[model samples]
Target: MARPEPEGRVRRFSTAERMVHRATGYLMLLCLASAACLYFGPLAQLVGRRHLMVTVHEWSGISLPLPSLLGLFSPAFRADLRRLNRFAVYDRQWLRAVRRRRKSPEARPAGKFNAGQKLYAGWIAGAVLVMMFTGLLMWFMGLLPFISRTSAIFVHDVLAWATTFVVLGHMRKALEDPEARLGMRTGYVNRSWAQRYHSRWLREEHVGDLSERRTVE
Candidate 1:
């Protein structure tokens, strides 16, 4: 027998949230691509292209943090962040389950942002801040002492490598989870999808209302 399709309005991300996410995504790609070329390959030797790429990379890096700041002004994003960033006792258990996924797939319950996702968010935030400060020092090299410039460059390179690895992992996870991609693409997930992956967020967002019940079933 065919089951009835779930009924309820699927909560969508706000336009502000989507916009900021998209902007940051584009800028991060730009920065990473340019940085990659500059860091390795003969591509950097193409006349003035290296310098131009560096300029674009630097500006894009500078723009990366704007989205999160703008997103903070959004009540929804702010609220989501509050929930997503809270470290839970269960998160370690979730992490353990993920590590043992081959043995017990059903043991791990998906979440709005899993333990891995939360860790990524915090890492990226810290990395960007460090990169911004170091980039600034590099940009205004002569204003600071030689020691500062040298140290900043060292830190900048280190953090850039760290970000590169983190972004690669993020991309890999997104590829592995098609529903996660769809959620971002459509700005909505099916009720089952939400219940399976983001139940806590769904509950928190729609507590004590007819909407919450509708969303669960």
Candidate 2:
């Protein structure tokens, strides 16, 4: 028998969170695109057009971190982040199930953000910090006389490569998970999706209220 479509509920991402998230995404994309062209394309000359691309890249990188910081202030995002950061005993089992492609139809469930999402969030945060430090050093090489300019360039390049790889991985994971994308898009998910991927959060947020109209699903 075909399974019925899971009923949708409300209570998803807030306007502020969504706006900040979208802004960050755009700025990150701008930074990456400009940097890539400057580093690996014939458009490198365009990078030197009044140092346009470099300036854009630097400013975008600087701006990208702000949205995430602002997101922390949102109660919804804060609550979600807390749930995501919680390290449950069953997370290991989830990892194993993921690897083996053997997650049972019935199993102990997860919260708003899974362990993988938490790890990704942590990694992106670290990457941004590292990139900012290295980028600043590159921009102001003479300010840090203790470190040679050549060494600063090397470190910046290395971190840039690392960030690129990590961001690509993040994009791949997002593409692979439709519900994950949908949650970001409409700011809600079907009850079944919430139950499967974020059961703990659903229970906490929507206790005694399963009707879709009662909450944002």
Candidate 3:
């Protein structure tokens, strides 16, 4: 028996979660901007200071995982990570509905993290690790004689472009859902929005509430 949500609002993300997301997003933006300046001749000349841009790009990429790694210390973030990692029966249904281009929210009802979001998170996590590995290889080419510098650079470049497009798509989708975006930005979502799109999560929250109350009693 959870208490009623106040002002039709319910907690969506913890402060730790929001902080990690913002830090990671800022670092990713920095990495991408610097990468563009390093890779594009026109932009490189426009920005000048090739040496400085290279240093920025390399360090930003290297630091990309720090926020997430630190966030793991927070129980709330770790719980969300578990949610993002696992897919349920509803996730499969959601995917099928998506493939059929179902436009209604009911057709794509999800828990805390949807099927598409889970996939994106998984893909981006893998991409970050791969990018970091290739970046290090490129940065210390002489030290890593086993790995080819040219190959590392090529893979890193292609992945950077792919990641950029995927991030753009993610942002576009976020923009379309103002309430969802607000949840990430402020850590609270309208209760009705959660009921409509994340009914399963709402139910789970209630169950946890009941369990906590029972233990206290």
Candidate 4:
């Protein structure tokens, strides 16, 4: 579903993918904001609704992955997931370049997701699962006495802060890559963007498009 558009644009994210992304972002924000109100003393009093905030936090956390889960029903979404999961030799090169903080793009054979994006995706997925598990434990502490409520709180708080900083860093990078943001907004990116950071991907897309055209002919 992600292909070249008319003019000099290429599709980056499909509309469904963008919708899933936006929904998940909103849910995550709701979870964070509600959690802050429930957890912080001043915020809790200022909000004057501990019970409501707690309910919102619990339900929002539970629903955080709902959009992504529903998106898997789309075959296009599944294929995009495959691309994200398939790391290549060039991914390793890119990781090295990132560790060194190379001043320029390393001319690595990047795919739809660069190695950094893939790694971040993997991390966030794991973090979400952990948070969910710990949150459920804390929500129903009496159900599982074997699990330490204190430990769950500690892990949840730590991961919440970790997720916050990681997301902030991601946002900062997104600010630098305005085209990437546009791709998510409108499901399309400039063709030159593909050539610049993902030349290998651009070449592969061209070949695939050409083959498809021939097949159509």
Q: Could you give candidate 1's per-residue lDDT for residues 176-196 as a string of tens digits?
A: 988777667766667766776
Query: Lowest summed-lDDT stretch of 10 residues in model 1?
Result: 1-10
Comparing candidate 3 with candidate 4, which one achieves the higher TM-score? Answer: 3
- Each candidate structure's TM-score, on Cα atoms with residue i matched to residue i, is 0.84, 0.81, 0.95, 0.93
lDDT of candidate 3 over 1-95, digit per residue (tens): 53455687989898899999999999999999999998899999999999999899989999999999999999999999999989899899999
Question: lDDT by residue for model 4 over 1-217, one digit each (tens)?
Answer: 4344769988777788999989988998899899889778998899887888888999999998899899999887888889888889999999887777774665555888888898888888899999999999998867688889999999999999999888888889999998999989998889988888888778887899899889889
lDDT of 2 by residue, 132-178 (tens): 87788878867877878788778767877887888889889889889
- Location of the lowest summed lDDT over 10 successive residues in candidate 2: 1-10
Q: How many residue pairs clash in each candidate?
A: 0, 6, 0, 0
| lDDT (C-alpha, whole model) for all candidates | 0.77, 0.74, 0.91, 0.86
Clashing pairs in 3: none
Error of 1 at 107 (Å): 2.6
Worst 10 residues of 3 by lDDT: 1-10
Ranking under lDDT, best-scoring first? 3, 4, 1, 2
lDDT of 1: 0.77
